[model samples]
Target chain A: MASPARGNHVWVGSETGILKGINLQKKQATNYKFGDAVLSRHEAVTTMCWGDPYESEIYVGCLDGSVKLFSTEKGKFTESRDCREGEGPFCGLAVLDGSLITCVQSGLLKVWRDTSSENVEIQVGPGVCRMCQNPEQLHRVATGGKENCLKVWDLHQPQEPIFRAKNVRNDWLDLRVPIWDRDMQFLPGSEKIVTCTGYHQVRLYDPSSPQRRPVLEATFGEYPLTALSLTPDANAVVVGSSRGDVAVIDLRQGRLVKCLKGFAGSVRAIQCHPALPLVASCGLDRFLRVHNLHQKRLEHKVYLKSRLNCLLLTSREKWENEDSPAELQSDVKEEEDDEIWNSMEVVATKRKAETQPCCESGNKEPRKDKPSRKKKIRKAES
Target chain B: MAEKLGKGRTSQKAQHNAEKAEAVASPGEGQGAPVQPDQVLFPPSFSVSEIKNKQRRHFMFLRWKQQQRKEKLAIKKKRKKEREALGDKAPPKPVPKTIENQRVYDETTVDPNDEEVALDEATDEFAPYFNRQTVPKILITTSDRPRGKTVRFCEQLSKCIPNSHVYYRRGLALKRIIPQCMSRDFTDLIVINEDRKIPNGLVLSHLPDGPTAHFRMSSVRLRKEIKRKGKAPTEHQPEVILNNFTTRLGHSIGRMFASLFPHDPQFVGRQVATFHNQRDYIFFRFHRYIFKNEKKVAIQELGPRFTLKLRSLQKGTFDSKFGEYEWIHKRHEMDTSRRKFHL
Candidate 1:
């Protein structure tokens, strides 16, 4: 599992009920859709998790309260099961030692045993936005959302949460701070769990500490801090806001290091490469962008037409050469050239013909006459 | 006649003094006493008829004329004294400070020949507090491998947006196109990447400044699905309706989405952009109106209707691996309920 050459496929789930596998080596993407006729048309893939360490089996949770199992190697859905009705969409999904773990927006966390009909269920709290499992301690998961403060649940205990975060004291205005943890992540080797809130706050809470409140808190953009990801080095956290502002915050100092700009809409999901100094992000803008964290340059960008919901980054190295055939590359380039020329030719020819004489004459007469003609048309219409 | 006149003058003087004494004693109620003397002196008395003989009448007329002249002289002297007391100053101008007494300056009083007052240049006093003005110009283009469906989707999508322009991504590097787009003042760029002739990937880059986001589109159901559900209305032309976005953020988001489509549709264009929400998922549908004549019309599928689910959003360009990059995940959580979100 620790090997670096395991796979380089980036799996992305979309609102259109399709799962896409992007082969980094080949620069190719393949879409996988379930063949089941009973699937609801409006059902969107909400949450996904790897079922096995080999990264072959994937469990997908849909908005329609159904969980489906897919084999990455086979590229087909193998099993599907309906969750409790009216649970809303799955807010989080994970796999712990062959048991399927799922959490819904209404805060019903369930663990389904592969062989037994019985399942373990716990109510984390209502309005739960996200749940994240600690890689080191798979049984421990953190859940938080609106009115649902941070809680660390140990699956083996199956009772009360091990750690429940208390709300911070009222702000300087003496107003109670709202609890809306949009995203959370566990530090690599520490008990500290960092959570980003809709209030644009990033807070680190150590369950081991005596205090229930966050040990450190920092704010980012003014808009809701929709999503956050831990840097590979674990020294910084990347946070995105509803207004499309993304920034890196130094965890030790609780200060923003830099901000990343270029988003028109709200940011939805972001991920940092586990081993590489790379970060891949997707959003309502529907473009998958891979940025080099060290150089702060966009390495690769692919436009996926539909709004993406979630993305999974693989550990396999990027395909720099050899996998993408020369023929396909050339073909892609030709098609792109043709597209540009088709649109540009029309505009360029027309503009050049019209502006060439105007430039040669170096007079404002032609420009003035153009408006006069338009004025005459308006007069005629009137 | 002289004795009668003397008696009348003595009574008038006594009445005036009585009114003055009343005014001094009861200031509040004395306002009514000054009016009573005028009412009492106006009527003529018949007791004066005895002085009507011819010679006596002539003497009485002379005496009356002389008394009237003396009264006029006294009034003139009194007025002169009052003027001297006031130091010959001009009459006090009325100050309209109270609501009832306030004056409204009418536009008609303005001097037409007065030079036009120059308006102060719009200050940036509120600029820091207010969101910057962004022109909603969107550039719709396709990915390098342009499929027919994706190209057509770009065309139809561009039409839906009011100030959008569509061009195929002819192998033109985004770097090159971005400068061009910036020069053209395009605020947004939407890239449609196709897989297997299906609109698969969507890249929306905010120009000049960007937190470019990529989305994966799936479960595309065209207008045929709406028609099958019997939800398509009987209209000759396609109409885009964005519904159920109630909050200010929702409204602005809806408006931002609506601004992506052209405000005025071309005569031949029939597509509509409908963004309706149920729960939290906003469903985007594009439909085309097919009409044989004026009477019978049918709805046809133009562009692929799909739902947009946010996957990831990065802060700047996709260059996170090099220097430093920050991003956020689970952006969809912010869209769940409008009440809690400030955006």
Candidate 2:
């Protein structure tokens, strides 16, 4: 079970309180539950995140206000903890230096430490739709929701937000535009955060910039956008609407890049591979679909049999490898060897033209020329 | 008796084949291949259409049609005679091919013994109805200012559904109406939307919480429009029949339709309402049956029949803009293969 769990490329959290591990190569899905307890909607998984950089430990937050720790190494739930401070389902979950950080829909964000007395808490705001931690800066996290604008907080000081975003200007009718950031992601290599709104708009917020309002904003379909994931390059963002419309929108010009097809329902969660041009999305349709971002082709689709809310994708380059870095190094060695062979061919051509022709003309005789000459060179090299 | 049945079947098959051939011949003629049929019938590719005189051409075409029919009848007669002579040793009749039989294999077809799917269905929104914890109280209405057949259709629909009430829309939004209906102890809401006085859309929202389903309604035949429909239905509850709901999506739709009616049907009413699914289109029929002796049963069609093709299934009640959809039909992407069906 542990070995097969390690082979899984995607881990999906479903509404039926089942954790599904899908191995794309084998086209198999394995369901993992916590205990002998019957599956219930109260324990429905709402958010999931890696507990460490190694991606071996997963922290799954449930609607019932408890967080379960799943170890991919053992392919089982190793520990279950209660973080019932929040009023609603968890909006986001992250781990920082062994400490678990959880934010709920009712805006209760807490940091769970080894000791109960040491845990820190912060009130982000009411109706927190989503909270996401910055991958580069583990201490930084952002929160946003309905009628609540974007706010970035530093975990070091939970007193107040470091950067608070202001809502966009009113519309042409001089009416206030509603603010609802359904899902958000932090752009790697930068402080810019991209968010998809319930108003069907995708807004990019740059905390480094002076303007608190969105640096750029773009709208896609007519329905509310539920989920968004940044592409590996981070030049464009993929957003899925409540009506199951998934599209990639360019950040630079805010232009629509392309649309992914074959989605039957509203997409709840979307995750793009950290390095590969592949994005996996799952939703109310109960199907986990992985699409090629470059070609916009649906590559793999697995029927999970329950509504999916969140998903975590393995970041390893080679899925079949137990230790991917070692295999990657071996791959690099093959490329280096090919380079050396190419350079040797160039040297052989230069030597043949510069020396072989001159020697043949001077002798005016071909006495075992090709074989003896190549053998002599080989002998000299050895 | 067997020989007569065999003869009738053969005649039907021959007539069907002739009709198909005629259809093919008409298309060939439209493409300027007037001699196509003549080429098949004779070695010399001479067509009656090539005749200079219009009267002669018409006369020759009539003669050709008669000849084709006579040849078809003779062939059918020969096959029938051969089958009759064989008697009990006759070959089994060939089964006809249809898109339903040739459907693409659906991976989500629910197996009865599948524990996960059984648990899922047991905990779904309609679980209360299946568990008999809540009684079905349906509220049927129409789009604001419904006219003509749309209004009458809702009235007839309400008659078959026990504890159902038909009301006017009054132009109120569905989002606002849902809360009031919940407070009023209504378990389900049915909204019939019409375009140009013709019912074209049906929205069924399981109340309080949902899994609202939207369907494209077509081919409406009200009592007045029907040729030989039965009288007005009685107040007694009708038995509900759901057919061909095999896939997971289809199962959910079937369960939704089932929850709209009462659990224990009044058998004394002798009326049955059926939602038969064929190639993804759901055909609704309400009928009254009479048990003719112990061996035979005859059914008479009650009024108001229509067809429904699923458009979308939303998660929560009537919030089309914000509610998450469970399944939505994408015409271009999903309809690529005629054999592929969602429900």
Worst 10 residues of 1 chain B by lDDT: B116-125
TM-score of each: 0.47, 0.86
Scored by lDDT, model 1 comes in at: 0.66
lDDT of 1 by residue, A256-292 (tens): 8877655545667889988788887776555577777
lDDT of 1 by residue, B218-289 (tens): 666543443443333222234558876553234334444554443344546565668875433567776666
Error of 1 at A21 (Å): 1.2
Docking quality tier of candidate 2?
Answer: medium
Off-target runs (Cα >4 Å) in candidate 1 are A1-8, A36-41, A115-117, A317-382, B1-343
Per-residue lDDT tens digits for candidate 2, residues A77-152, read 9999888996888999998888999999889989889998989899999999999999999999999999889999
What is the fnat of candidate 1?
0.00
Q: Which stretches of candidate 2 lie over 4 Å from their true place?
A: A320-382, B1-45, B81-91
- lDDT (0-100) at residue B189 of candidate 1? 78
